[model samples]
Target: MALSTSNRAAPSSYLSLGEVAAELGITDRTVRNYVARGVLPAHRIKGSRLIRVRRSDVDALLQPVPVTDGGDAA
Candidate 1:
């Protein structure tokens, strides 16, 4: 799916945690953990378990994570 550039300034205006995960190519759990660890900010919807993640926050996570070439630990 193509990401809309029309609202680039406000990307997270309507994105959910799941959507963020898809955009970042990560698992939903990882997105949730971000929220848990305070890396990503989220807002709880009234009368619902749904959580919304800001687009800017997700964008920040796109930075490359340092890792070893192999699957071994650094």
Candidate 2:
């Protein structure tokens, strides 16, 4: 049996909790809270305290703000 490898690769990257926090402009503790609350997903390294989150997952967290008419008279 032989393993096969593909020449193509996806643009996926993993980020640490601190990195995720920095990207979101929030505290690392807050990032941990989000993970704990299931708002964000995280993966724990085997036999280590390190945790990793996919960059795409972090991007998914971002949402556009809705604009309101603010009662403007036309």
Candidate 3:
């Protein structure tokens, strides 16, 4: 007997907290906490937690912080 393959295609990118953490070089718990704290948005698929952070968001987070002099420059 031969098995049949479905025509469905796999998702391009759906990540769990662990996967997101690995990608961002952070701890899994940090990802979860960020989700909980509403810093990062996440969605639930079926019954598992799925976090889908865009590359832009990651880049924004990785951007260098701006430095301010003690004088009022406005």
Candidate number with greatest TM-score: 2
Residue-wise C-alpha lDDT for candidate 3, range 25-52, written one tens digit per residue: 9998888787677666655543333345
lDDT of 1 by residue, 1-74 (tens): 11222322333375787898899899999888877877777766555656776676677777788976887677
> Model 2: per-residue lDDT, tens digit, 1-74?
11122333323487888999999999999998988888888777555666777798899899666888889688
Better of 1 and 3 by TM-score: 1
TM-score of model number 1: 0.62
Give the number of the best model, judged by lDDT: 2
User: What lDDT does the true structure give each of the candidates?
Assistant: 0.68, 0.74, 0.58
Ordered list by lDDT, greatest first: 2, 1, 3
